[model samples]
Target: MPHFNSAHTQVFQNGELTLGLMTPFGDATHDLADMEDQFRLAAMADELGFKALWVRDVPLMVPQGSANTASNLDDPFIWLAGIAGVTKRIALGTAAAVLTLRNPIHLAKTALSMDRLSKGRFILGLGSGDRPAEFAAFNEDPETRAAVYREHWKLLRSALSSSDEQRSVLRSATGGFDLMSKPASDIPMIVVGTSRQSLQWIAEHADAWATYHREDARQQGRIGLWRLSLEQKGASLNKPFIQSIQLELSSDPDTATEPLELGLRTGRNGLNRYLAGLKTMGVSHVILNLTLKQRNAGEIIEEIGQYVIPRFPP
Candidate 1:
């Protein structure tokens, strides 16, 4: 809300269409042992002309939750670094990192190192943790997650941006300043969820705002809130309104209105219609998750690259 370019304007000036993969790590259908599948798929995404690759900071997944079977995975930072050496054209970003569960200083070190390794291609996504089980195992409380989350995000930002004189007070540093290289700039940080964070807070401190599974009809009002918050703060941002959606483009083109957690269970027609509505609602980018597909990730990728992206917002 303070001062940043909206992701919408930034995206339009650059390229707007983006694709997110929930890394097919534990799929029993294929050889799940391929640890590098994420990297390989990321590279393939870039080669196939995708804009960015989204990774996540998932440590523990709720087995019965909507994400129950989806998360047979690890920390996203590891995956980010693994693919950094290979990916060139596509920017790397996170869906959201559970900051409340990590040591602030350590997390900062990882963020800086990943950005440096990627040559300023990293976008840090952070969120308040909602998983009580994860909080319990780590000796954290769900109620205090917001506080911890803010504290860690601020600490990480300060560490990444501080000079030697400013950082001298921390008792310890990862790798003693030289262990992990620093990124070229203050790597952009994005906020995940509403998080009880005010518009003034977001406009003043955040680089972008991320929402999940918003209905098509509601895009305008949602993005308008973000924009109004930015305007009210008297801040200028090169920020954009970014949202993630789930889609199932079946073999049939007609839309199917079915029940879904954060997205629609629709075919190509509904998918396009929804996306078109988003474009009109002033959304700059949408990270599509094809986890609802009846087919494999490779097949899903092909379907999108050939059919969906070609018609993205101008």
Candidate 2:
């Protein structure tokens, strides 16, 4: 059965650091994740105490190039539902759910329903859709994501807030329409990347910020630039900062220490060696997904939980 507690709810509230795993395979274009493993691995991640398992919302990965996809390819939500039934505590999240592709009504229902199943453990992150091909499939112009995303984001918030009339815009036209099962709390919405909107808007509206993985030189630059934005916007809350890192944790966490796709292919030890540096560099959480990784994903997870976690236990 699904379990809920203050610890799960507090993943967003303070200086908490969390980890996430992307799907278990790699992509063709841009090398983003395309295929993923069967649900069994994800359930294992849950038992191991991973904060979340992120799935990509890639609709079309360059079309005709489907066969080249690395692993089992299917709709992410299907996988989420399957994983939900098996795991008790882990969160099912997208590195971001591209709001521009999905209909907001359906998405609201899906997220809230998942929260109910997980007993209020859903945390949603979104961004202006990045893949142009995906937006095109929905008959949407890639350039129009900023406007559409802002509207959808606002509408979802209102619909999810109250079970009262007038505030309900999700299902029926009447205001008092309530979503079948609203989430226990304001389901967190973290914006992944900048959408050309004001930093103030993100600060005022976003529950947290999700950013990309950067090497040392670029990492400092990112912290500087984003901190400037936060300072300029006069942001007050201790909004958490989460980034994704692709790693290859082998039997020896020391042997793997070179850059791979968007991340390094370092052994578990090398990965941990750099984490303290990252924490000091102002990253609140790091979701290290060995997805599309070079080594065994399950072995990596165990190694991380048993050996690496003791050093910098989240």
Candidate 3:
């Protein structure tokens, strides 16, 4: 097993699909996660042997977009911090944090703080900003976002590594400085999407690759593409692939898969089969969003724990 961090070890099992829960545990009837209940759900997930608990960085809401726009109204760092206090064992991750919108120094400090709080369970997933509102509001040029993304990544990596011989300096958009409190363990970074960078760049930088769920054959193609990119770069094949899916689990164990918003409505049997397919395609982790479910979050989680989890056994 890789010894980088608890999160890395928990997520990658060589040939298995480790399950994770995305925050705001239940269905979102009000366009927001139930903040009151989220703490409880997070604790349950941790206690129930879930591999990870994922959160997203939605700094601002773009009101003019689709109906699926987020309204959770919580900071990712704050939420993860709270969950860290309440839970043990389950890895805490950012489904992704928008690196282009924040100061790299502050991001590094905050990420290290969270890693410390969680005892090295933090996975700092990064992405180039996608929303126009976010880019405009932050005065960041979208065309140069990819370059900025790479710069931020390089600075963070340097900040986190040991430089006992000499101090490490990081240059940001405005100024240059050294970040403090490097994490005790290497915080695993998983790049979400292409982030307007090449696969070769991703292979060179990211500890893992995280992408949206695709159909089986297409997903396999992506896995093949990732492996080929790594092979070309002489990179380690130990890098894991992560994918997220929205789930609406059914009561009937034999329920067939039906399309839903960015995921599927399926029973445990169907969910197991889908996960098995992903595992076979070299996917190491599956972060499941329960924000579109028809069943109770606790009930669904309990059922998954009882049946599906044993089959995968993260």
Q: Model 2, 1-314: lDDT tens per residue?
A: 11233323545435545666777433334543222354667777777777677776656654433344422345666656667777777776666777877778788778777666666666677777665666667888877778888888877765555334424555453355665755445667778877646666777777667777888889878776667777777775466677888666656545858886667777767877777777777777777756544556667776777766566565
lDDT of 3 at 115: 87
* Each model's lDDT: 0.65, 0.66, 0.81
Query: Which tens-of-lDDT digit does each residue in 47-84 have in candidate 3?
Result: 88899998888878765335654444578999899899
User: Ten residues in a row with the worst lDDT in model 3?
Assistant: 165-174
User: In terms of lDDT, which candidate is stronger, 1 or 2?
Assistant: 2
- Whichever of 2 and 3 has more lDDT, that candidate is 3
Predictions: Cα RMSD each: 4.2, 4.6, 2.6
Per-model TM against the reference = 0.82, 0.83, 0.92
For TM-score, candidate 2 versus 3, the one ahead is 3
Worst 10 residues of 2 by lDDT: 1-10
